[model samples]
Target chain A: MMKKSDLYIFAILIIVCVLKLVQIGYSRINFSTDILLNSFKKNYGEHIALKKDIIEAKKLLIENEITNFNLSEELMSNGYFKQRIVEFSYPIRLNETSKAVISLRNKSNTCKLKSKLNDLKLYEC
Target chain B: MNVKSTHHQDSKLLIICLLISSAIFLNYFFWAINALSFLKYVNFSILIFLISYFLVSREFKKYNFIKLFFLSLLILCLGSALTDWDARSVWLFHAKRIYIDNDLYGGFDNYMPELMNAYPLIAPSLSATLAKLIGHWNEIFPKSTNILLVLPAVLIQCFFLKDSKFKLMWLMFILLFSGRILINGRTDGLVAIYFVSCCLVIFKLFIGKNLNFLSIKNKKINRSIILVLGILFGIILTLLKNEGFVIMFIIFISTIFFKLLTKRNFSFEDLFFWIFIFLPIIIWKFMATTGGVYPRIIGFGIEAVYSESLTQRIIIRLTDLDNYKLILDYLILNEKFIISLIIFGFAFLKNFKKNEMIFKFVIFNSIIYYFLLYFIYLSTPHDISWHLNSSAHRVLISIVLLLTYFSILSFQGKKN
Candidate 1:
């Protein structure tokens, strides 16, 4: 019912469509990481988490110097810290202000923790 | 043709249309996803569909499917490349600020106020809307949006031309060759679309015999609509970029010249037409001059009012010819396929004399319009490449429209 040339054109178009779809999928995956970085950069504007701050947060979680401690839900929500926490040494209660200080421990070390309890205020810490 | 054969042809036609539509949609889908601005993409898609459906339905008999398919392919490549072209850096960067800063009127701190002042508001406004809707204003969204602007221009061109062999060839040639120019998302694409729409409206009013206006035996409503559309388009052109106003003026003047050269009767309608077209310019100029939005240039033989500053020197340096040549080289090399198509367009001019007078008029006006732009750029203080890069390919939009019209006319003639 269809000419050979017409079928050939259809095949070519289908191929192009598939190729385009794959390209878009690849580009999306490739750029999503950049988008994530851009989102952070836009929100924080060059205020990267210093190595000292990360080390201090980790140290505080390990040592009991941070008693009656509170970590804001914000601290837990920050993508960087969420992925880092290994195990909680103490049961941390979320305050009315959404802040909590908990002793956290890994195989390495501990120190006093200071963080806004509210999830939204985590970026500030 | 047998009934079986007719059914088969219909199926083939359906397949072709679906493929073309899919290609367009795929490009748009990628842009929307990349920008994370699905709503804005939807708005643009609706507009594209409406315009494309109107043209395709109206002019279905005029197209040769195979030729148009190739032409569409060429255009698709150009449109997609807008997502990454370096020359579009300024616009793409500006779109980010629309969301990041949330202030549209003031110049973004990174770009010069003068440079920012020159941009038309529509594309940027649209980009900003996309940014807000998406909640992320990155470079990709704006770049993708700019690429989408090509749809209107392509749709309008398809609408005006009748179906024919020459039309197919010309359409293919123009679409494939004008790649570099169309993808940049500058004001030129909008101007070209506006110019073509104005021409189509004018043609329908003055030349189309079937449409009766006011039920008067000889009168037509087309001219009235054309006059109104021309004024609206004129205003739009002026607002889009500073040079848009100049281009509109050239087109208006060229139309008058074409009418005269062809010995077409100059009616009172023509006078009213020109006046309506100038209305937008007059209003904008009045506001600009009196609103005190810009610094007044004042000087005398003995004294100067405003201080002569080193700032002007830097502005001049940025627009120099060397910068233009670099951009030109970039576009030519990057868009080699499109550039080749444009070269082929030159050969079609030899067959021009045999075409209808309206077709010839459009071609003549388009040539003069581009030539004047080149001349003005050579003489002006601005960087030659910046001016040319900004506007040259856009000029091809008008040529493409004219060539399509001529092709249709020639094809119809051959059939007869």
Candidate 2:
């Protein structure tokens, strides 16, 4: 026959087991806001500037300094937008190289944006 | 003459108890918020109290509760300190991966899929659940989570030791003090508990011929309970780790071997018990194999280039003595060795007659299982060393269970 003491011990053990299960269950419902923020920062932060670069590259290509441009392919491959541009001032005096200057400015602008985005805190979205 | 000795002992016990309580309280108070969730820490405290209560009040009535409590605390403290170095970053972090994704099958993207899936789901699943609930799956949570996993086994151990006439208090003290238990929280501890429970149930049911099936006695009900408990224990073992199934298989085979060797008539009830114990394991194996949870071996076939390469790697690693030494050190020094010794001692000393038969069968089966795995590891193509190291604890679950059973059986004999 099962003794009363044995039953009590069993009951206590069962209660302990139930308590553990409940505690574990309770902990599962809570989400870590910090982890979510960190994940968002890691995944999304790197792509932000690459997105802006495509836009700037598109504007520069439309201004007609660079030629033989395919924006869709460029955007797909290098995050740079492609567009046709006519230019004649290369290998000449600084004053006449307005189109070249515009292309240089666009390239630098994209590069600067990329670097700035890279500088953002990894865990900051 | 009696009052003075009693008064002195009571004061000594009170002091020891106070010290243990303070130490545990302080330890928990400091780490409770940062490492462990509030509920988990509290639960752990409750568990310790329960263990102390059982051991001091009933099992070893001669021993003062306070002294045993202190000894347990010291053991835990030492074990934790010794094994605390790299586990936080390795196993505990891996557990966090399970929690974050909430898919035990979804392999850790950072590690190889095979390597990631090598670990059983129970420990990680529990950690994941805790992480999910706590809102922060930090390193501390998983490490501290080991306490819960170890509790059932420890409690069952107490039950096993209850009737033991030996200085079980000292044995408990030694087991607790053993450093391995403190170091890492893994699934092997649970496996040990399950194995011990299985033995206890088996012992309770089949120990003496006094409880025969043909007799109009409680034997029938008892046998049914044993069958149910054995099956439940086996399923729990299988779920905890893949090696758990191996242990169950060994136990089952051992039982059959024992019956056959002894010339015991196998009846429907015996068959039913075996079926009950083994059905879940077989079903699980089928599911695991079919589900592609583990790689399946078909008929003997020629090895591919990749398979050949893996075989070479496994061979080289196995041949390296240094690697084996490192693994042995890691496993033995950690809580497993002490626990195993105590269980083995108890089993060898107490369960000498029929119980020993079961123990020997189990030991034989375990040896075979271990050797088979070793041979397979020797032929594996990848860094089997890394895989083995990671899953080492899981492998020891059976041994732990066997020892636990022995310990329990030893104590159970004391009652008679």
Candidate 3:
């Protein structure tokens, strides 16, 4: 029921639409990639800061007995950690000899305490 | 020959397109913004409608030039980021707030008094809805929504030209496509396209041919279609911007005057249909007024008109040749106005006396628009020079489209 010319016209339209789709997809990908990169850099900086706080907390525990101890409370009060970390890690009572080793893990191991080595420092894995 | 009822079909399609865009806008207002849910599924449905509306429509697919041109414009729009200050600071900024908050009222943070948060939500609603659908806000896709708003009017214009000579069609294409506003993510072009198309539909349906009561069996169907289309366009015209509402009022008044002279009658159904179409704006205004979101603009009041400085302001503006010089330079240097003038001259010469009443309506509508612009400039709340210099050209787009449309109709011969 359609003419050859109509078919040609439709083909041209389809081709143009494909080109448009490619353009949109390509631009969006580039934009999203840039944003993701920036956010990753920001998150990496936060991890570094969290490591510093853990180091400070370890030193405090080594020096004196902490009566009211909440690692998240200390870190958060210092304005470095976001809310998600509060629920992940729980408060622990430490002896003077025992060292707290803080390391960053994948999302699944976010607040879990991994194997403690001889070093009393914090590690971000 | 096939274009006999082309204008009728064009009106219907234009209304359908605007209504869809309006639906998207209102969906954000009443539903998406409140739920705090992105309504990604609804947005997906809209995308399907957008693609199929053009790609699958037999009328559109047959017009290769228009189809390719429209798709290319969409591609260009999507590829570009939001760069215009008004686009970035005013339009898309509003969209960002609404999209993030998912609350229409909370979106008012970006709507500062001087920045005009008082403007309507239709354009921002579309952009915000696009961002919601995408689940993240990027500068490009949301602005690309302008193309979606523009496509319907452009396609309807193309349909109106379906039977014209190829050369004429190309000319119309070049003229309409040359505007920078179309690509720059501004609502001015959208307003211009819709308002001009609204006027065209009105003229075609009322003043031209459909007047003979005895000839057609489908008259009732045709009248019902126009009534529905008018109400749809009326709703959109008002919601697009404040100026849009004024233009719609002018059209309403002018059409009623013409109808009275012609002794055309309407049923109670027509009145109710109009009331239904206008209900959205009525509710919107009620919210705005009761909530004190925006102060009522009292431009028409006797108090404002008879203010002590009216004469002083008028004399001062008129005496300043700089204002005339700036307006002249702006109009002359603008490509849209030049093309519009040429086409109007050609149409006036070719169809000198044919469709005189229609041309009168065109001229009347144009004068009312320009007069309002001139009056606003004269009594502006901002610096007059800056106000006129910045906006005169953008506002002229509606008039240019009006003249060009009538010129095209003239070129198509008097049979329409």
* Most accurate candidate by lDDT: 3
lDDT (Cα, tens digit) per residue for candidate 2, span B1-416: 25445334333333333333233333322332224454544544554565466346533343533234334333332223112322432344445555554444444232322223444444554555555555663323344445444443343334334332333432343233322433245445556556655555554454333433222444354455445544545555665656566666666676666666767777886677767656645654564455555531211222432345555656666678975775565455447645666667766775656455546655665567667666555554434555456655555555654654455454444332
Q: Please state the Cα-based DockQ of model 1 relative to the true two-chain complex.
A: 0.04
> lDDT of each structure?
0.44, 0.44, 0.57
Question: Which stretches of candidate 1 lie above 4 Å from their native place?
Answer: A1-125, B1-90, B93-104, B107-111, B164-171, B193-197, B203-235, B262-278, B289-356, B382-409, B414-416
| C-alpha lDDT of candidate 1 relative to the true structure | 0.44
TM-score of 3: 0.68
Task: Write the residue-wise lDDT of candidate 2 on A1-100 in tens digits.
Answer: 6688766764654454344333322342122333224422312221222244433443443343343232222222331122111111111112222222
lDDT tens digits, residue span B1-416, model 1: 45454334333333333333333333333332344445545655554564355346533433344334433333433223233322233354445445454544433232323224334354565565655655553323344444444443343344333333343444444434343344444555455555665565555454433332222421333334334544554555555555566666766776677666656788887777767666645654554445344321111121222233335533554467675565445333334324433542543454444444555556666667656554454443444455556545555455554444444444343211
Report interface Cα RMSD per prediction: 13.5, 18.2, 12.5
Candidate 2 TM-score for chain A = 0.26
Candidate 1, residues A36-121, lDDT tens digits: the string is: 33431222211222233444553454443332334444555654443222111112212334333432332111333343222211
Question: Per candidate, chain B TM-score?
Answer: 0.58, 0.58, 0.83
lDDT of 3 by residue, A1-125 (tens): 66888667556545644554454435432223333233212112123223444444444444444332333323334423322122112123322233342332222234435333343223222
Better of 1 and 3 by DockQ: 1
Interface RMSD of 2: 18.2
DockQ of each: 0.04, 0.02, 0.03
Give fnat for candidate 2: 0.00
